[model samples]
Target: MLSPNSVYTSKKLGHYIVTILTIIAGSTVVATQINLGNRYRGFTITQLISSYNIFCSIILTSQFVCSVLELWSRFRTLNGQLLESLSCVGRPGLSQLLLGWRKRGNGEDLAARLRRLQHVHLVLQRAAELLQAHVSPAVTFHLMYSVVGIIYGSYELLVVSQAQNRAESMIISPSTSYSLCWLVHHLFDLVALTVSCSILEDEEMQASVLLRRAVGIEETVPQVEAFLRQIKRGPAICFTASGLLPIDRRLLVSAVSAATTYLIVLGQFGLR
Candidate 1:
């Protein structure tokens, strides 16, 4: 009786719901396992929590190293492409320079000046394009890895809470565990953002140096200084707005406070 499109839509919605439920069920099992492990092994919940973080840190570090290597490879590839493009325009060879100019300054032949200017412009434009392209994937990879690390950290936090049987220790509704998960997730994200921003800023400065060289400019310290200034200012403004501001700061703060409070309470009551 239903239209084909409607039937397809319903099926898709059903699959999505099923997927979500399955994830929830899987998480519940993991939490239960953590709780059982703590009980049977006679491990203090705090010890279990510490172990979880240690494990998560090891995993994140390995992934971070792999991501850095990948980023470096991409950066090298981008540099190679830019260099190849510059080579196509031909470098200022010794023979070309040996052809002495017949005139000086503004009196120089218009055609020659125009050619030099065109080459400069093309080099600058290509450098700009390459810089833009290089930044996009680096930012994307950082964000993707940060997000995954955040999720893993969140799961560890949730397991820690469950192991302690202090589910209500989270400030937000414990019924919506995902919200608490995200709060912890964002904390890890803040650290990742800072590290990634530093790496990107360094790469931008290097790219600027390469660009200046391509345009036949002497790569002076002042020019490098200016590039570093731009890198320091630009990405922070963009990344703060893009990454940090969107997170619920108040919720995160409250969750952290709650976590501390839970630790104190355990020390007083549970540990005693």
Candidate 2:
């Protein structure tokens, strides 16, 4: 069983992380909105309104990212507990090599452990369901916008590096502060997404390892094998972005690499 105090503490920690990320996102977004508004002052009111709408939409997206991070943390805690519970079942489902193991009432222990494992499995399934529900609605738009934003950030960074090389220095100004804040926000977003997804993938593998060990036990417990076949029959429980792609460390690396590629293409083409 999971301790209530520990779960609450984990939740609190997640909230703190979410709060900090939100602050970073909100501040950068506000500055961006202000800057754009000034640049388009002569534009029609409808155009200005549309620009602000885009800003608000992205700010909401950052909030969703925070929520997803929290869900990932919670699932990680549940999976860890499940792994520990499986370890308690002991090896080979018996204490000794003696033939009368079942006759000595070890069956009861096996039965109880099997039940406990079932309960943990259900908890894990529910956690996945909850995460999917939250992710499904936004998954389509989320990836597209995130990729574009990160690509743009990478391009800006490249431009700044080249400018510094030519001038031997850079100056601090409002625009520079805005660029720095945007870079920080994007970098923080990347780390949060990568860590959570990687943790989720690790837990998925651990669950399979635990199930494999349970299958090897000599005990004829039907539930144990049934559970294994159910979970591993199709796929291990890992986070997916709207069933389009699985989110993991690989996704993180791929996103960054793709962004870099786009940055190079845009640079060579000279935006001329």
lDDT of each candidate versus the true structure: 0.41, 0.58
Superposed Cα deviation of residue 89, candidate 2 (Å): 4.8
User: Which ten contiguous residues of candidate 1 have the minimum total lDDT?
Assistant: 99-108
lDDT tens per residue, model 1, 2-69: 23454454445435433543443345435434554544565466545544653454344334433433
The list of candidate 2 runs beyond 4 A from truth reads 33-109, 160-174, 217-222
* Residue 248 C-alpha lDDT in model 2: 64
Best by TM-score: 2
The best candidate in terms of lDDT = 2
> What is candidate 2's local distance difference test score?
0.58
TM-score of each: 0.30, 0.68
Please provide the root mean square deviation of candidate 2 (C-alpha atoms, Å).
Answer: 6.5
Q: Which residue pairs does candidate 1 place in steric collision?
A: none
Misplaced by over 4 Å in model 1 are: 1-42, 88-197, 216-272
lDDT of 2 by residue, 1-272 (tens): 55566467556756766676768766776666665556555445644564465455555545555555544455555545544444434453342232112222233455556566566666666766686677665654655556666776666666555554432133222354456666666656655655666665675566566666655643465766776776676455666777787766777788889988898896777333
